[model samples]
Each structure stands twice: as C-alpha cells, then as structure tokens.
Target: MRLRLLVIALLTVSFLGALDNTVVTTALATVAGQLGALEHMSWIVVGYTLASTVLLPVLGKLGDMIGPRPVFLSSLVVFMLASAACGFANSIWWLIASRVVQGMSSAGLQLMSQTIIAHATTPRQRPKYLAVIGAAFPVAILIGPLLGGLITDYWGWPWVFWVNLPVGLVALALASFAVPRIAGGGRARFDIAGTITLTVGLVALVLLAAAPGQGVMDLWMLALAVLALAAFFVVELRVAEPLVDLRHFANRTIGIGIAISAIVGVGLFSITAYLPTYFQMAYRTSATVSGLVPIATVFGMLVSNLGTGWLASRTGHYRPFPIVGTALGAAGLATMAALPVGLPLWVPMAVMAVVGLGTGAFMSLIVAVVQSAAPAGETGAVTSTVNLVRQIGSTLATAVIGGVIAAGVAALLPVGLNAATLTPQVVHAADPALQERIAQIYRDVFAPVFGFLAVTYLIGVVASVLMPRGRLSDSSDVVPAAESVTA
Candidate 1:
C-alpha cells in the first residue's frame, strides 16, 4: 500500500510537469492580449520546453550523484513556488521567466520520478508501473488544450498556472512521507566542461529548429550547434565522470531502444500538434470541439498502453510489442494518408486510434528495454539519454512539418492570400470558394506529411526487429542506489 502511494505521488508530479507543457497553448492568444506581447507569445511555450529539455541530463546526473529523494522533493517545492510566481505575474516577460524556472524544476521532477520508480521496483515489476506512468503523458497531452480553454473561459488565464498548486501540494505531501531515501554512489567528479558544451549545443540546435526564418542567422545557428555538439563529444570522451556515458550507445538493446524512441516521439508529436488545427481548418469546428477530436487516439493509447505493459510483465517477453506496434502504426498512417478529404469525421478518428495503439505499445516498453540494459548504478543516466533523444526528435518533427505546411500553403493558395496571416477566422470570413480552396490545400499538404510519417514508422519497425531477443529479469533486487530501502 505504501509502495502504491509512492507511485501515485510520482505519477502526479510527472503529470503536472507534462500538463504545463501544453495547457497554456490554447490560452496563448488570451495571455498575449492581456499581457501586451502579441509578437512573443510563442515564447511562453518554447521557454518551458527549451529549459526543461536542456537540463534533463543534468538533473538526471544530479539524482545519481546526490540521491533522487532529495532532488525529487526539492523539485516539487521549486515547481510549486514557480507555479505561484507564474500565476501572480503582472507582465508577459515575468510569466515567461517564471515558466523557465518552472521548466527547470520540472526537469528534475520528471527525471527523478522515473529514476525513483526504477529504484523502487525490481526489473520484473517495473513494466506495469512504468506503463501506468506513461499513460499520464498522453492523457496530459490530449486534455491540455481543452482544459486550458475551459479554465481561461471560466476563471481566467492565471488559473492555468494556479491549477498546478493544489495538485502539486498533494504530490509533495505524499512524496515527503512515502518516498524512500535512496543513497547515491560515492562522490564522482562533476563534468563541468562537458555540461557546458552539451547545454550550448542543445540550445543552439533547438533554436535553429524552432526559428521561423531560414536566413544567414539560421545557418550560423546550425553551424554553431554542430561545432558545439562535436566539442561536447570530445569533452565527454576526455572527462573523468562524463554527464552522459556515450558508450551506452554501443550496447545493441540500448541503441535500438533509443532509435525507436526517437521515431515514437516524431510520430506522436506530429499527430498531436497538427490534428487540432487540421480539424479547425478542414472541418470548421471550434477550438474546443477540435481539441476533443483527438480523444479517439488517446483512448486507443490508454487501452494498448495498459494491456502491453501487463503482458510484458506476465510473459517476461518484450521485443515483440514494438515490432507489432510499429507495423500497425505504419499501416494505420498509410491508410490515413490515402483517406479522402470528404470522408466523415469518424474515418480519420478510427485511423488515429490505430496509430495511438501502436505508439502506446512502444512507450513504456522502450524505457524498460533501455533501463534493463543499463549497467548497475547507471540507470538514471541511461533513462535521461533516451528521453533527451525522444525530445530532440519531437523538436525536429515540429520544425520540419511546419516548414512543409507553410511551403505547401504558399504554393497552393491564390495570390493575395498570405499564408503567414492565415487563420480559421480569416478562412471562414473569406468567400466560400476561397475557403474550399484553402481546405483542399491543407488536405494536399497534410496527406503527404502523414505518408512521410508512415515511412518513418516503417523505419522504426526495422529498428525494433534489430532489438535483441530476451526476457527481462524477474529478480527482486533493486538498483545499487536503492538497495538500502526495505520497502
């Protein structure tokens, strides 16, 4: 019972972190209008993502150095304080700054939550727990926009940030009482140089991907990212205790799991990011209604996520899930690509469910594979690396897909129709013929993008097939760091 409570606390923290990533998305226009920074509104989302993503490995390594319990509890405290700051902010800049701190703290919460779970459970019991935890992310993603809209309408935009406080307080109390104190390995040398280079490289790379213009500045950013990343690798090789153990990539199971994780990130983000807008433009649905449309996909993900985890734990066989999942995902995406524009809404919803099913199969299983393959005392590092790769993949997908849609609209839209200024209201206000034309342009653009995503899933299927054949250990022994905890 105590163990279950600990898991609940960890999941609550994880869910809160993930929810903030997207919850403000629907309320952005409202925030900008009142806060008076219409041009920089996107930063509200980007700032949080950028801060959290860049610090993932840092926080993970800290968990390994000092202990996950202290880091976890400290993060909960900081996250709540930051949330309060965000809620009380008087300007957009203040809120963005607060959100950056929130993101930094969230990085700890997310990384330590998973690290604690890996320590608290044996390899055999890990899958089911991870599966339950994994469901929080997709659930958060699915409902974030809907919840944001409702909160903004009824209470106000500040309530979006305020909402985290109550949930966070509950999580903090449970964690303080229920979480075990895991000891870290004896003090290791901190890799300051490697950390610096990696942070620079990631910041540059993410900026390059997120930037709207493809100018000389972008080229410079790309070059800087490349040079910084190359320097980071060199530093990691020379450092006494590197932030990330690069050698982990040489292990077959770990390498393959990371590759599949990237693919899953790309597919998952591409669908979730675009579908709501697609519904708005293509079906003329309101934002709230469009947000609800993705529930089909979320439903499928929940069912498959729980089922696959249970089966993996019961049978002790895991390799086949991703292989089957990716194949199903590819088939489903291919069907969606070929779907006609005029089909009833149910048709696309059904297809997205298949993609979600495939995606869910990969979620918890990939983490299990990578962590199971880690050398004792290195689970935190390995887990953080997998998450980092997945996040990078998602960032790249967002950039690439955005470029594709922009280019397609620019080419297909009639003269005088500015793709940059196009919105659902603009389209609705336009003549009927123009609206139909805009809809068809989106259909043409998105179809090819979906087909491209399907091809990526096929590649994932190939990667999954290359994964080592084995059953995860059923041992009750915990990781070295948590061996002292009797519970």
Candidate 2:
C-alpha cells in the first residue's frame, strides 16, 4: 500500500510539473496585457525553462547526497510558495522571478521522482513503471494548452498559477506519508565549481539557441557558451566528486544509449514544442482546439510505452524495441514531411501517433537500459546524466529546429511580409486571400522542418541499429550485461 501510494504521489507531482512547464504558454498574452509587462512577457516562460534545465544535474546530485525524500519535500515547499507568489504577482518581472523559483524547485521534484522510481523497482519491473512516468510528459502537454486557455478565459491568468497550489499540496502530503526516508551517505560532498560552470555553460547555450533570429545564433554568445562548456569538461575530469562522472561512459551500452537518448530528444521535442503552432497557423485552429492535436501523440505514447515496458519485463530483452522504434519513427516523420496540406485532420494526427509510438517505445527502453547498467549506489548519477543529455538535446532542438522553422517561414514569405504575419492573431486577422497565402507559407515552412526532423530520426535509427543485442537482467540490481563486462 505504501509503495502504491508513493508511486501515485510521485506521478502526480511529475504530472503537475510537466503541466506547469507548458500551461503558461497559452496564457502568455493575457499575462502580458493584464500585468502591463508586454515587453518582458517572453521572459515569463523563458526564465522558468532556463532555470529548470540548468538545475536537473544539480538536483540529482543533491538527491544523491541528502536523500530524495528531503530533497523532494523541500522542492515541493519551494514550488508551492513560488506558485502562490506567481498568483499574486503585480508585474511581469515579478511573475517571471517567481516562476524561476518554481522551475528550479520543480526540477528537483522531477529528478527526485525519477530517482525514487529507479530505486523502487527492480531492473525487469523498472521499465513498466517508468513508462507511466514517461507518458506523463506528453499527457500533460496534451492537456496543458486547453486547460490553460479555459482557466485564463473563465477566471483569469492568476488562476493559472493558483492551479498548481492544490495539486502541489496534495502530492506533498501523500509523499510525506508514503515515501521511505533514505538518508544521504556519510562521505558525499558537492562539487560546487563543477555545478556552477555547467549551469553557466548550459544557460548560455540555451539562450543562444533561443536568441531571436532565423537560422542564426549570436556569434559572441556562442563562443562564450562553447568556452564555458569546454571549461566544464575540464573541470569534470579533475574534480574528485565530479558533477557528471564521465567514468560511467566507459560502458559501451551506456555511452551509446545516452547518445541515442539525446538524438531522440531532438526529434521528440522539436515536434511537440512546435507542432501546435503548425495547427494554429496552417489550419487556423483556436488555442483550445489546436491542443487537441497532441492528444493523438499522447495516445500513441500510452499504447507503445506500456506495451514496450510489459514486453521487456516479460521477455527480458530491450534492444529490439529501440531498433524497431527508431526505424519506424524515421518512416513516420518522412511520411509526414511528404504529406500535403488539407487532407482530413486525421492524417496528421495519424502520423503524429506513429511518431509518438516509436518515440514512446524508445523512451521506455532507454531509461531501463541506463538504470539497469548503473552501479548500485550511483544510479542517481547515471539517471541524471541521461536526463542531462536529453535536456541538452531539447536545448539544441529548440534552437536549431526553431531557427530552421523561422528561416523557412522568412524565406517563403512574400516580398513585403514578415515572420510576425504567422502569429495566431496575425494569421487569423488577415484577409481571406492573405490568410490562405500565409497558410500555404506555413505548410511550406513546416515541410522542410519535418524533413529536418526526419533526418534526426534516421540518425536515431542508425544508433538503434548499432545497439548491442543485450537483454536486461530479470532480477533486482543484478549487474546489467554491459556493466558486468565493463566493470
């Protein structure tokens, strides 16, 4: 009963965190107008996302040192407090600051939950459970925009922040009652320099990716980010209690698996993050209706994620799923890239379902593969690194894929047109002839973006193809095949 309750609480927290990550997006314009911070509106979401991304590895290390229960509880408190502050904020910068705190603490909730899940289940059982957690991300995304819009339209933008309070409090209470306390080790010490360098490096990189432009990053900022990352690598190698511990990568399976995870992240996030825009611009769907597009992806994730986990648990093999999933993901993306505009709505949804199924299967398998390979006490580190790579992947995808789309749209626009013409309001407000022309431009912009993503999926296919034909151990913490050999 405790275990079941614990898992449920953790899932709720994770689901809520994932929901928060996306929920505010639909409410951005409303927030700017109401708060009178129109100029700084983008920072509301950007600051939160930046803070969250930079802290994943740091919190994972904290969980390793001070125990996940304490870390999780602290994070919940911080997140709840910040959520309340967000609700009452009078200015845009104030709300953005509160969200930054919320984001950092929520990062703690996310990683600690994953770490707890890893510790809670055996290798064979791990995938099945993690798939449920993995499915939470897309599921939250499926619900976020519609929910955010409804709340903002009916009550107000403040309700968007208030929404997290109830869910946060409940998850906190259940977690306190149900989670077992696993205290930190006696000898663990934080690598402060490593953490600082890495965070700075990542923030710089993500900002460069996020810089406003088409198909370009600021050269000076890019240089600084590169230099910081290089310094981070050097620092990691020399530090006694290193942040990431590159030693783990000595295992071929783990090294390759992390690489594939990053690439898959590029493919997964590029679609999920931008496809809603495609719906609004090309199909002229309302914010609420545009959200429905991701439901197909969520459905695909539900089916394949659970199926992959159950199969791996039963059969004790994981390699085959990645091989098949990545190949199929490539195929699905290619088909979507080829699909012309104005088919039945189901056509794109069906393609998204295929892509989601493939990626879901990949998500299910990769967590187990890496966790299964972890040395008993350092599972947190390994899990953190995998997540770290994946986030960095999202960062790269957001920058590169976002840039590609912007560039594509810029190139396709009429002589007098600007990229702003594709905005939901702009597109909707235009004359019928202009709207159709813009919609055609949107279709053209997205086709190449889909093709670009298809190439990434193909890259994933190659990585999956090269995956060693190893099976997961069907027992708890028994040495994984790759780890046993390397160790």
Q: Whole-model lDDT, candidate 1?
A: 0.85
Q: How do the predictions measure up, each by TM-score?
A: 0.95, 0.91
Best by TM-score: 1
**Tens digit of per-residue lDDT, candidate 2, span 117-218:** 766667777787787777778778777888898999999989998999988889988988876666555345788888888888888887777665533457
Task: Give the whole-model CA lDDT for all candidates, comma-separated.
Answer: 0.85, 0.80
- How well does candidate 2 match the true structure in TM-score terms? 0.91
Clashing pairs in 2: none
> Which digits, one per residue and each the tens of the lDDT, describe model 1 over residues 407-487?
987898888888889898898788888777888888888889889999999999999999999998988787433236422
Worst 10 residues of 1 by lDDT: 478-487
Query: Worst 10-residue stretch by lDDT in candidate 2?
Result: 478-487
True-vs-predicted CA distance for residue 246, candidate 1, Å = 1.1
Tell me how far the alpha carbon of residue 162 in candidate 1 is from the true structure, in angstroms, after superposition: 2.0
